[model samples]
Target: MVMGIQQVSLSADGHRAAVVSLRDGVPSIYLIKNPFERRLVSDTLAPTVWAQRRLRQVPRLAPALALASEALRQRNPFLRDASYTTPPAGPLLAASEPAGSNGTNGHGEAPDSTRYGTLRVDFRNYVFSSAFDEARPPRATPSYYSSDPFAPKDNVDENGRYRPRRYRLYFTPDLVYGAAGYDMLYGVQSVTQMMFSDMLGNHRIWAATNLLVDLRNSDYLIAYSYLPRRTDWTVAVYHVARLLPDYALRTLYRYRHYGLNLSASYPLNKFERFDFGLAYMGVNQTDIGNLARPPVTRTLFYPSITYTRDVSVPGLLAPIGGHRLALQLSGSPGNLLYGRQIRFVTLLADARTYTSFGRGLYSFAFRLAGGASFGPNPQLFYSAGVENWINRRFDSFPIEDLTDFVFATPVLPLRATDINTLKGPYFGLFNAEFRFPLVAALLPGPLPILPLYNLQGTAFLDAGAVWGSPSNRRLNLFRRDEHGRQVLDDLRVAGGLGLRTIILGFPFRFDFAWPFDGRRFLHRRFYFSVGLDF
Candidate 1:
């Protein structure tokens, strides 16, 4: 297994022969005429390379000349003559033609004769790395040469067969330090994350933490994943906590919890996958004001399954085309693992489609999402507000009793309203947004002070509804009627304009909306959130 000639094949015409050689154990092909025989008329050997080399690439003289002319005119006051002040040429493919009607080139007086332009080389290794990086412990290392580098090579192995992938060491793929926070909820938080994986990404390890200003509120997480075969397995553990202040009741609350989780993800194909998870967590909610009182405590065991299909084309600011769908079934069942009183079953579906206007990134996005709960202890759901919103504000209908429901479901982004504006057992939502970029191709990249990217504008509409059994008088969808009974309202709708940008590697979003029903025209709602627009 040397980096030298391995095999050879000859054409029927005895004038030429095809050579199979190895470079660092990888194979390549070369052709030579009259093998094993050489005849040179001159006594001295020729130069190995007589001219500059290029690999299927060429340069033109027009742009360089145009640039030189413009530079000369701009810096010299004597160049005010119309004959010397022509603008530079526009961007175009490379050509040898002269710029701006200059019929003659710098060497116009030279005699018209042909000579070698360059040494056009087809070094296949430059096209791509050696397909074979590993070979059965080679005896020794040897060099190789090729004339027809484009010719394909054969991997007969002296005895015909194939090779397999070999194991590789881990390398760092993600390492970052960034800021994280929402206005009133999490004030000026910071997060750091690191991840390492093998060359093929078949194995990985991740460690992340959010250690805030107050050490008591620190959160830590670590995980390991193995995906060498058909199934991907992940094991994770976390110790996370949060502290909240309430000025109204003159109380400070702390939600201290820890959890361990295991999951397996199996790819059905390239665009679809199945994920199954089992997790356990212990919750502790304490009111600091009354230390003598026992904190609200609960233990839960969760088992879930999800199916997702994503076939989206990535764009600068967002997906330009295709769609994604995710359907999930999850439950916290009593006695399934540990907690005896915990019981709930939840089903959710989320679908999104992004369609661009031809090749231009005039992205039009639409999303539909819904969820439902079953069993006596069904999970609570919330509606309204963006994710990780800052400078938070609430409308006249202030949300109440959100502490118990906040952990039950993720915030459904319903701009024009505050976080947890509505809560219920079931809810559905629809969203549509038209996004266009301002100099998207010319990116707004990172600066020394702040990292920023992907600036785009959006026009959007959001509509959603949340409701449950009329008997549940505590639900936000239930309002007192003339007869003092609970009644449900029609769909809540909002239309708005928005902007999207990424700062500190986070998708920072801003939205302003008005009540689409026209009843609240004067009331304009503004939201600043940290997340991509759905």
Candidate 2:
């Protein structure tokens, strides 16, 4: 029974009491801090002690906010990093940063290291992070930038894919209940029917939800539909939410008709994150009928901002990247109901980057987008395509090369009464596709419950066309075959192929497409599907 004590510290309220003399059991001291800050202070019975406590004395360089909180905990793992209790040797408080109670502060924790990025928007998602000073800026009408400045200025790709937080639930119910409640029925019955219809009765309900929170952190989408009409009864709600860790508050409501969005960000280091936003959109509709009959119209508003960027370049495969640029500017305000509107938006610069190309085993994906639409009815635009999957060669649907104009509103109409034959919006065909994947990678293994049901093949070609003419010239409004010519100015294609039936308990796929040139017989028709035709 022997014990001796000399000194022990830690009391300015950080509680600690220890003294030894009578019989061992009192000589204890604990204070652990290592392998990257793990502060522990106590009175342990010496289970092997080594003293030197100093966990984070902050002088900057916190592994880049711990790699942006480990890419938002690999896609939102709830997010947590707030603990406090320290006063011992005192002398701290002022480099403070860790706030998030709506007030939201910076850097939370959970990042050892990471890299891999590409998040740009133009097809209307609007976001163009940095200005990229390549010493270039001399065009006053078109703008969009963000092409992988090295990705990671706080990495953000809000589930366009980086995977995680993917959810979907659908339950359809139909029986019958009418009073003022459940009596739903949706539309779209066989748009070309490939078969898949019970065509249930009149009482139904549908719901959809999606959450891709934390990546860039926070994003949510919700959809709802309800019906009951023999006279009138319809309800539809759509919501979109985004808080994206740093700065962004996007909210959209489709009921009382309101939309508000705000964003702010500035990261001059790590890579780049210079966001900006200020939005206000409105819509209102009313018509309950009978009650003296008044409200027939509603309203609309717009104020926009979108500047996005998420970069990281270096790939041979598996990581080509997308959204090189996006820019938007909108204005709305009209009289006599609604008329004055303006839009100057440019997206997916460098032809809508959907780039994906692999060697060694083969892979490919493509895209196209050109721009123009200035002020009161100005037009000029474009689109192209390409997408291939090696082990599965030959499939189609890329045909896109467009030019606009020929509108009468109230649901699209080819209008032109002269203005020099309104030779405005030219160009044609805006969509195309091609794919081929025969035999599940030439299979060699797995086939019990038939897991790798090999051989998957396809061949295809499709088309689109639109170029204008017809001011006082009406050849019966268009479309004529059998040598009568004038088939909406021409340019239409469609090819065929089949047998991709790799079925089992059912991951199911069965497609058949055929439609060569055009004109009646629905134009060389033949189509069936479950999935993957192109």
Best by lDDT: 1
Score residue 41 of candidate 2 by CA lDDT. 77
- Every candidate's CA RMSD: 15.1, 29.2
lDDT of 1 by residue, 288-326 (tens): 888997777667788999999999988876788999999
Q: Considering every candidate listed, which one attains the maximal TM-score? A: 1
The lDDT values for all models are 0.66, 0.31
Off by over 4 Å in 2: 1-206, 214-226, 231-233, 241-459, 465-499, 502-534
Runs in model 1 deviating more than 4 A are 1-184, 198-201, 212-216, 335-340, 394-406, 438-455, 469-490, 502-506, 517-522
- Per-residue lDDT of 497 in model 1: 90
Model 1 C-alpha lDDT versus the unseen true structure: 0.66
Q: For residues 1-534, write the lDDT of model 2, one tens digit per residue.
A: 334555544445544444334345655544322312435574343211011113322223233233345555334312212112221132221123443344222232222211122322122333666667655785543122235444423344575544333233434444222211110011111111011112332223333333344322222222222223322222323333221111122322111233444444444444444444444433332222232534222233333444445453433212244434444443333222463343333221222233334431222323332223344433332212111111121121111111121111010011111012123223222222233345563343565454445444434344433233234222232466678865533343445554454444322333343433344323333332233321
Cα displacement (Å) at residue 202, model 1: 3.7
